[model samples]
Target: MSFEYYYITVVSLVIFIVALVIAIIMNSRYYKVIREYLVQARGAEAKGQAMSGEVEVLACPRCGYSTTIPFRVGDYVGKVVGETCPKDGERLVVVAIYSLRPTEYQGS
Candidate 1:
């Protein structure tokens, strides 16, 4: 082949190699960012589960009898629970819902 053709071929091969290297570097960076984000998201989810829980305070309207129980799904303040009070056979109502974590309202 002519010297011109050989030079052109060499330049083209070099350009292709440079483009391939750039693509690999960019892909590696993208994957690293995605991996870090996923790790952070998982850690946050686990921390949330470990840190907070809810409890329901049930009270009898008639007798002023109150008790605490683990909060169930769909339980809300003012909701009537299926269980009745031991004192007066009155239907118990959810008087309050609070988290297990200590907050500003809870004094030291």
Candidate 2:
């Protein structure tokens, strides 16, 4: 084989190998993201079941009053919520967040 032909063949093989590696790396990342989405979706479905949901604990820093409510998407600890304290009339702040299962919640 001519030296020119051999060198071109080697270079083309190297380029193909590099492209294959890059594609594999990108596909692995895509699959990772999909796996994470599926896990989150399953968690959301569990939380949507009867008496199972996430809750946020809110407190009034001024009067030390506290209450629990259903969790909202954007809620975070130390966030000031729009609801006023029933006892103190002050804005409530989120103090904690947690999930409740069917056996844990006792609704009246």
Candidate 3:
């Protein structure tokens, strides 16, 4: 092969390598931004749910049917909801109030 052909082949290889490196860097940064955006979106959803208040587990004392209600203003953990259970038309009683939040792991 001629000397000029070898020189052209080396330059082409260098250009291809540089182009591949640039593409990799650009995609990595783009994907990093997307990952951060998704994380923030999930955090926002969790925050919105937390702001809605504690979860109230209600059940009919007669039929044992259960349901959940979101706690509101002036509502306490054991406050009986103003509605009755549809299963038996019995007054629904607050069974449990769950405050769901991320906490440190405590070994059981």
Candidate 4:
């Protein structure tokens, strides 16, 4: 009957709204946890930890002018990406990689 169909539709609408509200609340809580974690990590960095950075050596094959760039994600030695050489305006190559480790602090 028409009345039975109308009742089911109303119940379904209410259930959908409830699910949407719960999902939004869960998403907000997840982001709040992530923000807290980042805050803690930044505090650790301020205490002189995580100061060293990775170094990259990129060289030009045409003119032999090498460049150093801080290594990041998706960058590695010997993988040629589209980067122009600053010295000779030629295609550059990643020649070497190194990690810049900070020296131990002396209790002076």
Candidate number achieving the greatest TM-score relative to the actual structure:
3
Extract clashing residue pairs from model 1: none
Worst 10 residues of 4 by lDDT: 43-52
The positional error of residue 105 in candidate 4, measured at the CA in angstroms, is: 16
Superposition error at 104 for model 2 (Å): 14
Candidate 3 lDDT over 1-108, as tens digits, reads 999999999999999999999999999999999999998898577557755566667788888998665655666656677878877788888888666633423363
The Cα error of candidate 4 at residue 22, in Å, is 64
Which should have the higher TM-score, number 2 or number 3?
3
Clashes of 4: 0
TM-score of each: 0.46, 0.47, 0.48, 0.43
lDDT for 28 (candidate 4): 100
Give lDDT per model, in order: 0.85, 0.86, 0.76, 0.77
lDDT of 1 by residue, 23-104 (tens): 9999999999999999889857754654467767899999999977766899889999998998889999999987787574
- Report the C-alpha lDDT of model 4 over 1-108, residue by residue, as the tens digit: 699999999999999999999999999999999999997777576433324666677899888988666675787778885779867778888998776664433353
Clashes in model 3: which pairs?
Answer: none
Q: What is the C-alpha RMSD, rounded to one decimal, of candidate 4?
A: 10.2
Instruction: Kindly indicate the candidate among 1 and 2 with the higher TM-score.
Output: 2
Candidate 3 Cα misplacement greater than 4 A, ranges: 55-108
- In candidate 3, how many Å is residue 36 off? 0.5
